[model samples]
Target: MDDHRIFAESLAAALAAEPDVDVSAAGSGPAALRCLERAAGEGRRYDVLLVDADLGGHASGSRPAVPVQDGDEEGLVDGISLVAGVRAAQPAVRIVVLAEKDDARRAALALQAGASGWVAKDCSLSRLLTVIRGVLRDETHLPPALLTGVLRELTAARRHRTESERLVESLTPREREVLRCMVAGLGRKAVAERLFLSPHTVRTHMQNVLGKLGVHSTLAAVALARRAGVGPADLTGDVVERGSQLA
Candidate 1:
């Protein structure tokens, strides 16, 4: 699963040099899926798949190069996105993603999507082979450089989510209604109309929401609200808040 045919095929040739490794290259996400499907149908399943993290770009290749369109299962465009699809085709397959740059964010996504590991595209051949073999033994592998980053990335995301939920929970019932309106892209005046409140009252509620969310703008408020799983105006339920509701 890479768009660069030379890189894909060259890597494939190198891996095939191993006496026990049977490897082939696919230049696009679709092509990879096809290979998996065909192999499964023939009852000759592959044991491993190495994919490029950044696929579907402006790269020339002899193999079929397909752009990562806003297509393919909820806009799956890159090797990280292709992880789930690969698992669907061959549940037993071990996937190791290759990235030109090491990214903890992308690595977290790959792991969550069922990839066994991720590695640098420029990693040494020996390390690459070691990772491939490691996954076969059901070991989750990552380069030492990415271990701390991925751990911190995941931890920070979790902490932020908890804080956001707590902040959203702190809002009064009326304040929650205002925050939901913000998420719907509603202006204070529009929110007033929808909620049957005076514009002055809407402004006050909006200010309170901003203050509670620790943000200075409506866009920031909406972003935090989304992180807290706040739905649109129509989807929000009027809930009663205790102690902090100076309503």
Candidate 2:
């Protein structure tokens, strides 16, 4: 036994019913890490690590600590980070993220961060057990709805990366600069001002970029630019654009 009393209890109960498996529990990320470290130190290792995404550390005075906001430099240890840490420490261990019903975004991030699979907490205990066993066997155990979303995002990201590389290869240096501005949602006049070109020249480049991208409108051009990895930082100068399109 290590720490997650609730999940550990449930898993223990399930494994008890099975009679062929041994299950252990940990309450916090640090405890889980410690358990793994000790097991490794003792030349023992578990088959898998199932991490809950919302273990908000220890509750102090009846309320749990709020999670750190996105991009926080302190690097808060949510479930995803916990699993990443575990993987870093024990690369051979399989990891499964236990997410909430609406955790599609977090689940996608987890997969990108190297989690083997994701299971929603709302699923049945039997389903959870099955997923746990499946992940232990080096198999994917994603729920159907979550699997669909993950696959869609993965495909979209791949397409965007591929299209961006092609655009970079096809465009001239100046055209690439204009496309970067467009990706930042800048208009013709704004792009011209940033590049020290006339508005007419900017418009001409925009049209050429659009034709090269096979897009029909400024909006479509911007969408294609984002897929090419053109962000505000890629802009020629500090031109603040409105209504940026993100992929």
Candidate 3:
């Protein structure tokens, strides 16, 4: 039997061990595509596509994790990309990426690109089988370590973007001027003098800017302004390093 057939047999055997599962396997992206196409044509559909990250490629000699490639730009086929391609070809099928521990980033990318779930290949056979079944049932199964990291990064990026937009929308011309001066490390009195306004007016504008930004102080306002993409040239000096603790 060919490698495809062997892989299919192994997968079949694994599924057979689980009495509740009834899985059919396809060896390659093209074969999987055809399977889905035929199923759709006949008004049928498979539950999921479990894709191995390194398919039809040799492992790198130096780094076991890497794949050997023929060219630089047109690199070797990655399993996550294959999942994306399968989803593109068969919009009706759910895709699950089977990747190694080091491929967590790639797996995360796959999820962002529309894969339903990611399972680490090194997981126990029972866990792997269970995750596959879960994916088939349209559920996401991620190891706790990987899931936490992915959630943290995604949340941080989202908050950064949101705060940036709000800060821009809330800034008035005079307040923006005061912010620029404050960011330059100037004291309240100096900022008022530079803008030719009363100290009380400067303090009032600073309070409004802070309240609108939902930040505690002028230093935090400056930091939020910078994160919101306000250029340093537009402002005066370096922003205070108030750690990014979202209120």
Candidate whose lDDT is highest: 1
Model 3 pairs in collision: 183-237, 184-236, 184-237
TM-score winner, 1 or 2: 1
| Tens-digit per-residue lDDT, 118-210, candidate 1 | 888788888987887787778999878889988988788778879999999999888998898889888978887777677998899999999
- Per-candidate Cα lDDT values, in order, are 0.71, 0.62, 0.59
Candidate 1 — which pairs collide? none
Which residue runs of candidate 2 sit more than 4 Å off their true CA positions?
1-4, 56-78, 159-247
lDDT of 2 by residue, 142-206 (tens): 66777778777778778877976797668777787788777777788877777777799788888
Spell out the clash pairs found in candidate 2.
Answer: 2-26, 3-26, 3-27, 4-26, 4-27
Cα-based lDDT at residue 34, candidate 1: 72
Candidate 3's C-alpha runs over 4 A off are 1-5, 56-79, 88-92, 152-247
Q: What's the TM-score of every candidate structure? A: 0.58, 0.53, 0.49
TM-score of 2: 0.53
